[model samples]
Target chain A: MASAREMRLRIKSVKNISQVTRALETVSASKVRKAINAVTATRAYATKAWQVLRHVAEQPGRDSLHPLLAQRKSVNNTLVVVITGDRGLAGAYNSNVIRFVSQRFDSNAVPVKYIAVGRKGRDLMLRRGKKVIAEFSNLPAAPTFGDVSTIGRLAVDEFSKGAADEVYLVYTDFVNMGRQITTVKKLLPLELEGEGLVEDFGNKSTGPTAAYEYEPDMRVILDEIIPRFTALQVYQAILESQASEHAARMIAMRNATDNAKELVGALQLAYNKVRQQGITNDILDIVGGAEALSAK
Target chain B: MTIRCEIISQDRTVFTGDVDIVVLPGAAGEMGILPKHAPVLTTLKYGVVKIRKGGKEEIFAVAGGVAEVQPDIVTILADRGSENIQDIDLERAEAAKKRAEEYLAKSAPADTDHYLIMEAALRRANLRLDVVRRYRKSGMRIPPSDN
Candidate 1:
């Protein structure tokens, strides 16, 4: 039972909070739109890419040329690259991804390395004193493929040099307008989709029939394709995570604003009731005093 | 019958429409396709992809990627944007070419900031220069460098 004065102050504070949340909600909504546009524009190409690669993946021993496609003899060391937002207030976006990744590792002795792309992720990993291989932050909203180049190069270098046997990417995957979930995908040693690596002529059986007589060989062609493929996917995933973050934040802020408004309305009603009761008491006391004077 | 073609890039979908024939600079060699063509897939080299849609003819410089053709649909997944012949500035492309040559001269891998970009630039310049050299398709040589 808060006094009228206290309730008045609380209502004022709640009003201010709702206004702030509402503003954030609007801002994030616009950003989400931009991010989604960027992603959607590239989706057609990505799908085509998937189809092309699926065709190639069906080929026999095609994976042999691409080292990125080459599976290691042993999974001695594993490195995970986690990407999360730098700022908070995006609902469970950052927390969900971070928590999921932490669960995956579950131990420091796994010989894991961290490549953090966002300030928030870098800070969290630094605090934990984990082995951070590379850290990049201050990315523009809806970054391009060029932005992912340096990081991609570093990862390729490490994998090629035998510093890491397996690499994984942890980021939030965009489902739709209102739903996003943390996605963990393997980066290194391309996973074969079909049956026996021997019988598996890659994802395509007939293969590209345009009659490609390579200048060097199919090996060199595949060599470049494999790393480029991995890097491109990573870049696409980063774009997805960014778009998801904005969408999540926009939705979260909208909910927060709605809750704050509801709370403010309830508090206002209580404050009004308390104030009216106090006024009624004062009027009754005045009437009693007048009645006593009349009796005298 | 005209076949549907989409010349897509990273930033956006550059062109999409029906074309009578599409010539691709395949990694193996120059390959051409007409409507009802066989299902063919091949890696594209950095060169010109000429398109003929009705009476209109155009040229596009495609970077490395895979191209797939299904009975009616011909899709090109290019690594870089296909800057058209009409849209290029010779001076800028020449400068870019010089920069790319300088970059290529460097022995270090880290120094090659964008191997694909330089390659694409070089291809685009060559495409523009070649188109300009040709008396036909002068409409494509309009120098849309500013855009």
Candidate 2:
């Protein structure tokens, strides 16, 4: 059995660890909330942006007029826009995305070029000997559309200029407080199934159909709408992924703290039992000694 | 008849309501939009856009972008806008203007950027001045300026 003093020391150590984790958990949770709100408020704009993009994606664009949308059966060059957190501590937030990217494009069949959006992703890819096309760092705590617009434009420009044949994005998607998932999505030759909350606006039960009146011409509107819409989607995804990472980190730290607390409680119970046994042993020794004296 | 106007900044929609008339600082010229205007799409310049809402008129500084108008709707897709007149930091605007002017002067003669930067600097300065003027005319206690 562990001595009372030893048990008490163990409990104390666990308590300290629990306290640190608990503090971290609280900090992360608040940060997560702010990030979540930021992402949520922009959800409507992002969705509308996607709707516009989808409309364009359905039609032939200047890319159809231009070379960007030109497709070939054989893939030679690919650009991957990798987005992650500047800071770490989120469980598997950064790693999952990196792993997913590696599995898909880490072969000699096609040359891969990475555009790292965050510091963590950049550092990770560089260490693994991946070729980084461009690196953008020092994004705000909560990113704005402007930041993403620049990045998106750069990626699109490179593709359109025939620098890369295709483009893709890798980031996390926020499910809820308890869960976040890594997702890899194609960016260029815009996906027909554009993403968002995936429901008709303000009508969750129903769905969105192509039902709107165009003022000038559908083609002209699409041209302006598509590029901006795509840029907005990329930016929106980054914001969502960032928020989810913070929440995941917060939940993980909270669990760690709770586990530590449970361990400390168990250790305290053991300490009490050891202390009680020590007292019983001392009392028995005294009683035996007295009885022996009486016999003498 | 009146026009429904909305001036949106990146952060949020700044102003939205019905107005009697609107004078936008268009890149081409000062474009006026009344009720039942022909659907027109033109780029905006960085200058003052006057909205005669009800009896009171409100002036805003618009950065620049496409402005769409129809009979009942006057929607603007602008880059930047400011609602809080008192918050325009005049000193900073002046400093920015001076800096931009110097940059424009020193820039390569063939570079088109001097025009854009100089225009931005002028807009910044003009916005600050207009806001400051509005604050004074209202006689409202101005919250310290923010650039």
Highest TM-score scorer = 1
lDDT of 2 by residue, A109-190 (tens): 7789999988989999999999998998778878777656898888888777777877887778776888777777676766
Model 1 regions more than 4 Å off: A105-111, A124-131, A194-216, B1-6, B15-21, B33-43, B51-59, B63-75, B83-126, B129-147
TM-score of each: 0.78, 0.67
Question: Could you give candidate 1's per-residue lDDT for residues A110-166 as a string of tens digits?
Answer: 588889988888887778777787888888888777777677777777888989887
Q: In model 2, which runs have C-alpha deviations exceeding 4 angstroms?
A: A1-6, A33-62, A65-75, A99-112, A119-140, A143-154, A173-185, A192-236, B1-6, B16-42, B48-59, B67-75, B84-122, B128-147
lDDT (Cα, 0-100) at A293 in candidate 2: 100
Instruction: Write model 1 residue lDDT over B1-147, tens digit each, in one string.
Output: 878777777666666777788898887798887997876666788777778765667877666676767667678877765656666576776787778778766743743547766765666666556655562354432221121
Q: Report how closely model 1 matches the true complex, as a DockQ value.
A: 0.26
Alpha-carbon error at A232 in model 2, in Å?
5.6
Sort candidate 1 into its docking category: acceptable
Error of 1 at A165 (Å): 1.8
Q: Give the TM-score of candidate 1.
A: 0.78
Q: Report interface Cα RMSD per prediction.
A: 4.4, 6.7
- Judged by DockQ cut-offs, the docking class of candidate 2 is incorrect
Cα-based lDDT at residue A61, candidate 2: 43
Q: Which candidate is the best by DockQ?
A: 1
